[model samples]
Target: MSLLETLEMLSYLVTIVGLPLAILTFVWEQRKERRNEEEEIFQRLSDEYREFLKLVLDNADLHLLRREGAQTELTDEQKERRLAIFGILISLFERAYLLVYEDEMDKQTRRMWQSWEDYMREWVRRADFRDALPGLLEGEDEEFTHYISQLMNEEQKVP
Candidate 1:
């Protein structure tokens, strides 16, 4: 073949080869970026799951101690300490629930919370444990009452 024809063929070959390599590089980079994003999502979820478990375990410990009447044998200061622990447990449970399920919580999450609610109900019904819970439930009742009253006031104002 003539030298000009050979050069033309070589140019065509380079374009075909270089175009695919460039496209392949772009696709590979996009795939890598997607993988990194998935890893970040998995890491965030793992951190959330760990926090949830910690809250559940802390609540269980505090609940069990109060249920067993271990506080009665201790001094008043010890009783206060136990109450503080119970308060911490409740606060942690509330915070974790809000973090994990801000708006649309899943069924498994609601089921987990329901289990905790039933346990709390049992605790509230126990005469010995009732005193331990008044602190946790007291502020909540007033908040609910205020919310209901505000709704009523707003309705009256409307009509």
Candidate 2:
């Protein structure tokens, strides 16, 4: 073929093949970046939750754990503290549940949250927690309440 004819064929081949491959690569890179951003957000959320729990454990309010099921009545102060602690916890976990419920979360993020599940179950099983939960959840989202109820039921059956 003449030089002009050969050049024309090469241009056509590049347009047909190279353009699509370049477009595919660009799309793949964008998806990967988006996935990385999502994973980072999940990691930060999980880390913040861990840190918050650590702070809670460091507080003296943990005496409530022992008093939770006791016949002794908690003072208004103690009950307020309990509500505050659990309120923080529920909000964090509810954020997680909503994210997962909507399928915006991936398994790796779910696995990261599994560490908190035991603590969550333990607290939800507390008598005071259950007693106060209905009132606390009254203003909350229905889906989150259902999710917490499901977690509670599932945990109760696990032992």
Candidate 3:
């Protein structure tokens, strides 16, 4: 074929093959970027959880309060302390529920939530926590409260 004709055929082949390849590469890159973003979010949430747990574990009173809660009528100061602790816990759970609801929680992220879920189950049973629940729920995100409610009921149903 003449040089012009050969050049035209090459351009046609590129349009047919190269365009699709380019499009696919672009899509693959986008998927990779999206995965990286999800991973970063998951890591940040996980790190925050770990650090908080470490802080509680490192403190004797905080650790006791978290594990057994109040065994008797608490003074106003104790009540306030319990409220603050639960406030932080519930807020973290709310953020996590939102992340999962927003489709940001991958398999690893969901797995990371297992401990939090277990804690929720146990926390809901605490007398101090039960006392605090009503006030805590009053201002929480509706969907997050609903999620916790389901967990609370599930824990209740178990023997």
Name the 10 consecutive residues with the lowest summed lDDT in model 2.
Answer: 61-70
The predicted structure with the larger lDDT, 1 or 3, is 3
Model 1 per-residue lDDT tens digits across residues 1-159: 999999999989989998899999999999789656644644565565456556545655334434445543566665665576556545544443443332454564565455444434444444444455455645554543343334334444543
Error of 2 at 101 (Å): 3.9
The TM-score that candidate 2 achieves is 0.75
Task: Report the lDDT tens digits of candidate 2 across residue range 24-139.
Answer: 99999998997787677667777877777676667555464463554656678777776887777777777766554453546765665565566567777776777777777767
Better of 1 and 3 by TM-score: 3
- What lDDT would candidate 1 get against the real structure? 0.53
| TM, every model | 0.38, 0.75, 0.79
Regions of model 2 farther than 4 Å from truth: 1-4, 64-73, 102-110, 113-119
